[model samples]
Target: MKFRFAMVCSSNQNRSMEAHFLLKRQGFDVSSYGTGTHVKLPGPSIREPNVYDFGTPYKQMFDELRRKDPELYKRNGILPMLKRNLSVKLAPQRWQDNAGDGSFDVVFTFEEKVFDMVIEDLHNRYQVLMKTVLVINLEVKDNHEEAAVGAKLTLDLCQKIEAAESWEESIDDIIVGFEKQHRRKLMYSISFY
Candidate 1:
């Protein structure tokens, strides 16, 4: 059977979206979500945050930000990122709510926090489904450039998982193998950069 995938991050605006785009492009049945109280992006100042809810229109937010603080929006690359995010049908969603549906075969989280959030939510709300899904945490930063780099890592891991699946390897084994490779790739990238 073809496996379904889900990518999750804190905001779902950068990291998860990048992986979602790459996996979808590669023909994986994948979705992306956030595990935050509310969707947040960098604002004009560190104290201020641009926040939105699930299903919020990207263009609408972009326009509002542009009108309110064009310089900040442009300087932070929010405009281009929003334009890129337009391809995503839905907005940021709390992972707890989304994961309850039990649709994904595998779930990849960009950080430990999100991974813990997914596990806690699943154990609390969908205990029966917890064992059915494989959740892996891959440490990644929540920035545009880091998102791109992390997307490449996600894509590589997915390809390796697919190959392992084709070889009739167990899900647990596939995850372990991919995770080891992912760590090596991350270390190599860090050292190179």
Candidate 2:
């Protein structure tokens, strides 16, 4: 049985979308989400951030950003990121808004804050299903280059998890081996829906 997977990040524009595109291409039952109040993109200055609601269409954001400052947006990679996101999903989804999708067997978060949000969201939801999900945090820097590297790492971890005869039974060994091979500490927690 293949595990249902979710990739989560603060805004879900870069890191999560990067992994989502790769995982979907590989035919994994995967989805991506954001844990932020609004999807945010870099603007002209540090104080100014382009923010959109969760359900805002990626195409709309792309067009708006292109209009706002085509050269700046394109140079910063926001335009390209939005284009990739549009190809993957029509709009950005908020993790808090989709708590009912607690059906995922594994949830990968790109940062510690997003991991905490996922864990907290689960705690707030009713545990009617009592389904156990492994929430793993593999910190990935949020940028075009880092996102690509993170997506590849995410795929590698997913492949390792999927290869186990019974992931639940061999989870410990799988995690240990992955950490050793990758030489990175993976933060994880077992939670119920």
Question: Considering only N, C-alpha and C atoms within 3 Å, which residue pairs clash in candidate 1?
Answer: none
Candidate 2 C-alpha error for residue 68, in Å: 1.1
Clash pairs, model 2 backbone = 127-193
Q: Pick the candidate with the highest lDDT.
A: 2
For residues 1-193, what per-residue lDDT tens digits would candidate 1 score against the true structure? 5777888888746888889888888898888888877778888788988878876887788788889989878888888787777776545666766656777766888888777777777656635533466677778877889889888888877776666644234655655666676563221100000
Minimal lDDT window, size 10, model 1: 184-193
Residues 1-193, model 2: lDDT tens digits: 7989999999747999999999999999999999999998999998999989999999999999899999999999999899998989899998888746567999999999889989998988889889899999999988899999889989999998899888788888988998898887899899998
lDDT of 2 at 63: 97
Steric clashes per prediction:
0, 1
What is the model-wide C-alpha lDDT for candidate 2?
Answer: 0.91
Whose TM-score is greatest here?
A: 2
Error of 1 at 101 (Å): 1.7
The lDDT for every candidate, in the order shown, is 0.73, 0.91
